[model samples]
Target: MKKHLILLLLWAVVGVSARAQKPATVTIPKNKYGLQVVSSTALYQQLVEQNPDQELVELATYIPGLVLDIKYATPDNLVKEPVYTMATAYARKPVADALKKIQEELKPLGLGLKIYDGYRPYHVTELFFKKVKKKAYVANPKNGSRHNRGCAMDLTLITLKDGKELEMPTPYDATVKQSHPDYPHVSEQVKKNRALLINTMQRHGFTVFHNEWWHYDFNEWPKYPLMDIRFEDLKAMKN
Candidate 1:
């Protein structure tokens, strides 16, 4: 009887300890738009483990001949601060897979994809809103950016030989009217380059944002949660 009692005691202790180790779920209060953000790494991991398709995957590992120039990791961005701790890009499984296809398509044409940003954390969006204080260029935290959902990408076309970026209507993250997809003031070559990019992405299940030539949303964006997991945490999980 004493042995059985000891086992029960041990079991109770173990159970309690396990429960304590589990990270508490982060409660994200809905913004005015009724969007619930996923701000906890634990919750994001649980969702991914439960449904592998929901995983935020590293782009370099998934795609070949892909160049990543994550601007948020540098001070060149509008925020004027390194918003991301690392210069890496991530996207959902389907988004990455689609990019891979796009890369393959561009290879024969001596062009490839150069990523500017992907999979932005929710907190970063809040920071951008606070800094920019305008909805014209920055996404309102009330409605988390598609990047927070790991379903958007900011990229430009680059030559495969010299890796030179093609001339677009405007630079990445430019907030000018020239950045508009239908802006008619651009030179013919710039127009051609922009058309090629928009057409290629559209053929591969991506829709270009009207204002940002570099930004594209994966058609399945609505299915994913707005994630705030950091790049370091995501890298640690892969290991």
Candidate 2:
């Protein structure tokens, strides 16, 4: 009888320890197309803790003199409505570190970086698809965007002294052929500026999105999973 009682106590302790060791399960509802997203803040925090390299590092914090002109935070974007609640930009640690180096290189030339968007939540991409209805410009919700994984950035070059943006192929989110990096009709000055931006970003481990001159994706974007955690939740996690 004493042996049986001891076995029961040991079993109970083992069960408790097993439960405690289990990682928190993040439960984001699968989309209509059966795509899973990481929506739980706790799960996101757990991920950052487990893999510090994949943590979504704030860009403004790491890149000195970086300017943020988040168009989606205002009603200036294609949707003509504010989609993001905050004007913050985030990227994976390695991507952010690469941008830091890019910023240093640009500083000597009297130029800086102005960010339009980064690390968008998965739900925002879904909404963009619904509103646009154009498969070419918007990311299909079935496969989330690189931005959802914190590996994509929409940015342009800016003059450091005046904080004015350099002339680019086209405005942000413009669905036009001129936005293409290879478009040949732009003036010499525009071409030069666009080339400078793209070459600099490329030298720092980023590749410009074929459709958008200002959009760039980190080489490791495919390694991260789709995340739906909101900026407010991320801010709270930092605090």
Candidate 3:
């Protein structure tokens, strides 16, 4: 009878373990009209569990002979440089598709998008506000932000032929008058590249924020939800 009692105890323990292992879901109180927030702890697992027939963004436009890596390119595990990567589907599938469409349009001109920022978390948004003042180029963390919703992105133009960056007048995060729209003394190339980005993204249904040259929000961003989920969660969701 001792063996029977032990088996009963073992079964009880397994029952409790199974109950405890249930995944938790984070319920978002609200989401933007065009965008949906991904707040659930189980979101990553849920996305991967499905055999969704998702399309990889069509990459029809390749720089004829360009090895077009961005400033974020990392040399190796040694951490020699920053890592360059294309935006993945989990965060903003539409944005990824937009990039592909932009690439297709610009292939003839030998230009490509060199993305600097996309799908930023609230934590990163807070950090950004700390570094840059709000008057000129600002991203407030308290209220809604594009990066928070994964509906906005910042990018610049690069030569598709040699993969070298073009002249943007100022580098990323400059936040000065030169980066302003009315700062007329800049080169025509700067304006042209900026316009190219604006027109292309707008064609693909993105709304441009006038103050900043590189900033864009999807027209459908209101349908998406805010995502506090980290980079790891995004990767997990992609699988």
Rank list by lDDT: 1, 2, 3
Per-residue lDDT tens digits for candidate 2, residues 90-127, read 99899899989999999999999999998999899989
Candidate 1 has its poorest 10 consecutive residues by lDDT at 23-32
lDDT of 1 by residue, 170-213 (tens): 88888788888899998999999999999999999999997888
Error of 1 at 163 (Å): 0.5
Q: Is candidate 1 or candidate 2 better by TM-score?
A: 2
Segments of candidate 3 deviating more than 4 angstroms? 1-26, 29-38, 43-91, 134-136
Descending-TM-score candidate ranking: 2, 1, 3
Residue runs of model 1 more than 4 Å from their true location after superposition? 1-34
> What is the C-alpha lDDT profile of model 3 across 102-164, one tens digit per residue?
777878888777765666655555555665445446666556577676677766777776777
True-vs-predicted CA distance for residue 21, candidate 1, Å = 25
Model 1 TM-score relative to the real fold? 0.85
How does model 2 score by TM-score?
Answer: 0.87
**Quality of model 1 by C-alpha lDDT:** 0.89
Report the lDDT of model 1 for residue 160: 95
